[model samples]
Target: MTNPERDPESGKLTERYSDEDFLEAVAELEPASTREIAEAVGCSRRNADVRLRKLEEAGEIRKKKVGNSLTWFSVE
Candidate 1:
């Protein structure tokens, strides 16, 4: 695993599942909210959301709607 590519325009490093650091965080704290994931990864919720969405789209993760919030989990 390696670092996610930085956004060329924003100059911010975007979170991605392929990132070693992000993957380690997720392994320890999945079935978590975007906020939790962001905290664990030391990223913004917006950045975590972006990565989570990508994982969901890639079928690597799944989300369950709970009340008005969502919890993410790794696909098993």
Candidate 2:
């Protein structure tokens, strides 16, 4: 997945993150919600959710329902 960032001064597009970035964010903030992960990754919650689901499918992460929200954790 390509996460592009726009330069504030030059208005140029730049790559901001990668799959590893998302993995690191989840590892750092284990048992975190999508919102939290997104905030940490400087992306939108929806974007985080999409990547998170992919990670979960790959068995790199796991998710559990905590009350009304789903919390994600790195798979050790």
Candidate 3:
């Protein structure tokens, strides 16, 4: 599934990320927060969180709560 959006300023199309993108981001930034993953994937925190949860369910990744924040880690 492709998430495509148009840039208001440039009036150009942009490609949103997928679950795989989030997974790669988590691997690259292991032990990162939702915000960090979202920023890296160019998506919203909520979006990243949802996909991250899905990946977690699939055993592709895991998360831990550090104080008030949830940090994600790659299983591989």
Top candidate when judged by lDDT against the true structure: 3
- The number of clashing residue pairs in model 3 is 0
Model 3 segments more than 4 A misplaced? 1-15
Off by over 4 Å in 2: 1-16
**Candidate lDDT values, in order:** 0.74, 0.86, 0.87
lDDT of 3 by residue, 1-76 (tens): 3578999999988757777888888888988999999999887899888888988999989999999989999885
Ranking by TM-score: 3, 2, 1
lDDT by residue for model 1 over 1-76, one digit each (tens)?
3457889999988645454555566667876888888888877888778887877788877888888777888777
lDDT of 2 by residue, 1-76 (tens): 3568899999999756687888888888887998999998888988889988998999989999998877999886
Deviating ranges (above 4 Å) for candidate 1: 1-18
Alpha-carbon RMSD, each predicted model: 4.3, 5.2, 5.8
Choose 1 or 3, whichever is better by TM-score: 3
Better of 1 and 2 by lDDT: 2
| Structural similarity to truth (TM-score) of each candidate | 0.69, 0.76, 0.77
